[model samples]
Target: MFSPHGPSLRELAVQALSSVERGYDLLAPKFDHTPFRTPRSVLTATTEALAELGPFSKGLDVCCGTGAGMSVLRPRCPELITGVDFSAGMLAQARAAHPDATWVRADVRALPFAGHFDLAVTFGALGHFLPAERPALFAGVYRALRPGGLFAFPLGAPPPPTSVPYWAAVGFDLAMRVRNAVWRPPFVMYYRTTPLAALRDDLAAAGFTTTAPALPALGRRRDGSPRCRLVLARKPADPR
Candidate 1:
């Protein structure tokens, strides 16, 4: 669902036919008006969670599209904030919107900084990365953080088999697979592929101790399970 300011069907069609980067570039101007932007509820919950764990210094927002995550980072880290993304168009919008924060155009997997930030956060970007690519991405985040620093993001509970949302995600993944099979410069975005166990293991292997905290603001499932959780990964104080 999109707001009145969101991209039109033709705009979305053009984006779907383009490469992921180019598609995002075309979509950047209207991205905040779409449901694709991380919800404010999740943002608030994450901001509060970070506040409880922090008073951090510098913060980095990986794949920070339109700078939504930077807003969450600013209060927790008073010193400085930086947003990095591969999309120049997104970075351009972010830079214009939040002139106070530094914006860098760089791939998350090959992030160009080491031990520079006290805190880092990413929102709604992991699904774009395949399971195997997670290690390199997590490692880059690890390298970007200072000793005793943290990297955090919120993840939702998997949709139940009987739910419409579950089938919707499955169908979307299937369609994407077919599209990638036929298209060049594949646009990789799959919601059902990444799991919590695999993600935690990858973060751990990348040398960060991890934890998942339930976000009460998102409410709970029928089984009394948290509907969403904030994943916090810490780069240890002693690197060795």
Candidate 2:
């Protein structure tokens, strides 16, 4: 659901018809007004989890839309913080909001940095990439980090099969499939695609040791599992 100041049905329709870059450009001004922006609660939980493993130097935020991940990166990374995304419009909003942090306009699949970051965090942006594309995305993040550096993100538990949220996600992904079938310049976002096990396997294939620690701040699901877990992937340290 969107706020009173958020994009209307007509505006959203037009955005959905455009390419991802152009769509975000159109939505950038009111993105914060919509539910699409990462919630402050989730951000806080992620920050707390990362703080335990950090005291890091340079930090990178992959697919950093509107710079929400910067809140987590700033305190933990004292030396430098950078946010990278392909959307110029999103980068512009991020620049205006956090003028001091470095904003780079680059695609995550081909991140243009090498052993440059000590810590990296991404929030609420994974659904944009399909499962097959994740290899490139994870590989790039691995390549971007310094030896033994980390790449972390908060992942939510899948809703129970009988739950309303589960059905809602199913419906949303179904609608997206239909939309992409009929439309050009498809907007790729699917809620059900990234499962925790698959993602951990992908991280391993990309040469990172991966772990998921339950975020107590977010509480638990009805099934007694943590509502959210922070996936921490660490690139191996170079052999001396």
Candidate 3:
């Protein structure tokens, strides 16, 4: 699932044993060559979806590795765009790619902003947080957004139990759990933790109304469910 320029098996193995920040730091140079980077098509579809609700001023991307989300945020956010991540190496790459955009190094669970952004988006970074960690993550996003501002991200539907992809995901998560149990500097990434219902409930508790719109460009599953949906959570215009 990696390009010719992607990290070697030795590099990936070493990374898996390192702390999350260190691991990503090592992977940063070759990140775009791996499947781990958000796809351009996904970014384009997200940009189209967010366009319908915005002419936003400032945009923030949480866990913005290598500035993929910055591309999506740029056309929609006329004023300013910022990306935040914990890995200094990743931030370095992002700064180089989108020099004009602000790049901050911060843990997303404690995002350092208050009512600052008109729009926020995160891509493929949720698996890094455990279920217990999601509340704080959502709360930070809520605090970061301006009143009536939006927080949007696309989530893929779980593969069916009978499918090979489904089993692969299970195996990956299982392996991760086993690794974390016996390893130092635990790398926390799990595929099965963030269900739609749980995310909606967390967003609501964080004082945002949530909606999930099918991303048609991503296509549908065999059972006809959307393969992916963009979860749009909006902070209320009037504070309660």
Candidate 4:
């Protein structure tokens, strides 16, 4: 699934054995060439979906790897744009790619900002946090946004039970469980952890009023549901 310029098998092995931060550090140089980077189609769809909700003043991209989300924020957020991630290597690549935008290297679970952004977005990065870890991360995002700010992300509808993607997600989670059982540092990515119900619950727990708007550009599933949706979590305009 990786391009020829992406990490080699040995390189991937080394990364998998390292902690999440170090692994991304090892992969940062060629990260854009890898399948691990969010696809352009997804990015474009997200940008389009978010454009309708514009003109946000300041934006934050949580766990923005290699700065792919900058395109989504730059057009919409006129005042400023910033990216945050735990990986120093990824931040370096992002800073190089979008030197004008701000980049912060800090764990998202304990985000440093407090009510500083008008809008926040994260893409393809939720799988990196465990279910128990989600509350902290979501709370941090909540604390980072001003009242009335929006936090958005694209979430795929779960695949049908008979679908190949369904089985693939199952297999991947099982393999990760086995790997973590024997491995130290425990790379935390999982394919099935952030299902819609769980996400809605977590967002509510974080005091966000949530909505799921279908991303029309992403098309429909065989069952006629939108294949994916952009989850819009808004901090209340009046927190009183």
Candidate 5:
């Protein structure tokens, strides 16, 4: 599902075998050309949803690779926008693309800000975090936002077990488990690790009131359920 400019099979193989940071560094230049990039359809849908909920001041894009989510933040929050990522290569590419915004090199697990933003968005980055690590990530995001601020991201419904995509994801996760079992510097990326229930609990524990809004732009499934939902998490106005 990659474009002509996307990484080759050998390049992907090398990336899969390397550490997450190194793998992303190798993929940074062509990341936007891959299926891995957050699709424009999702971006547009999220922007529309946020428009109804916002008129925010400052926005932050957590793990903002190539700054795709920055466009969504731009319309919702006008004063300032910041994109943060631990990947130097990805941040460099993002900086070149959006010179008007600030780019900070920092890990999402330990975000380096407090009460600095009115809204935060992340795209296609959660899979890189293991289930056990989500609490810390959510906490960091919570700490970065001002009172009554939001941390939003889109999450798709899990693929059916009867589908090819389901088996593919299962196989990919199995392979990653084996790789981590045998390799140094574990590369944590699992498609099925984060579930809605667990995530809701984690967000609540981190002091956010979470809501899942149906992303109508993505349409519905055969069962009439939403294909994707945007997780809108608001940090309580008073943490005390």
Candidate 6:
């Protein structure tokens, strides 16, 4: 319903009634056409900011919906790159868009890899997991990367309570909680769940040394703080 090329309201309703994996599979064909696709500005900003920390040998895109992140990973990681996600339909789109890169189908909560990639990135996919599910996801990403490898993703600044976007997010999350409570198969997505502090704690528990550098490319909020920050979670060179 977002655009001419996007899914219709009926299609979206059908998808929502299904499981998260199934819902995404139904949406996969029109996913890129929707507002849900990671914004170009975010991708461009992330690519530029991440460039300085890289020259990485290999890269990975976690929960890679349609492989948009492969573009960010390609230049700096000259050797090879791969994308992984649970939905076969999403993988189909990603594989078609970027045939040169490997696409593996697997759930992000239990990502399957270890010590293989020097750089890994995920974009616009964090809200899929609940607070309790983050540890497994973070741990898996930690294990997927080579020691000292970097895992980066762009995180937006939360809106203040006074703002329209803040209330919108709260309403959206509350709707999701209600939907999940009543639905047969839960579609687990929430807007307000992943704040910076909670994210840092989860990453730390997963053995990542975390830093969030403000993305000036995304501009500043009304309060003059950054509109977005890139979370750079590095696996210790020595995982001891």
TM-score for every candidate vs. truth? 0.98, 0.98, 0.98, 0.98, 0.98, 0.98
TM-score of 1: 0.98
Judge candidate 3 at residue 176 and give its lDDT.
Answer: 98
RMSD of 3: 0.7
Summarize candidate 1's per-residue lDDT along 116-141 as a digit string, tens digits.
Answer: 99999999999989898899899999
Q: Which ten residues in a row have the lowest lDDT in candidate 5?
A: 184-193
Error of 5 at 163 (Å): 1.3
Off by over 4 Å in 5: none
Candidate 1 local Cα displacement, residue 142, angstroms: 0.2
Q: Model 5 over residues 113-133: C-alpha lDDT tens digits?
A: 999999999998888998888
Local accuracy by lDDT, each model: 0.93, 0.93, 0.94, 0.93, 0.93, 0.93
lDDT string for model 4 (31-106, tens) is: 9999888878888999998877766999999999899999999988999999999999999999999999999999
TM-score of 3: 0.98
Query: Per-residue CA lDDT of candidate 6, range 7-55, in tens?
Result: 9989989998899899999999999998889999999999999879977
RMSD of each: 0.8, 1.1, 0.7, 0.9, 0.8, 0.9
Compared with the true structure, the alpha-carbon lDDT of candidate 3 equals: 0.94
Quote model 6's TM-score.
Answer: 0.98
List, residue by residue over 60-122, the lDDT tens digit for candidate 3: 999999999988999999899999999999999999999999999999999999999999999
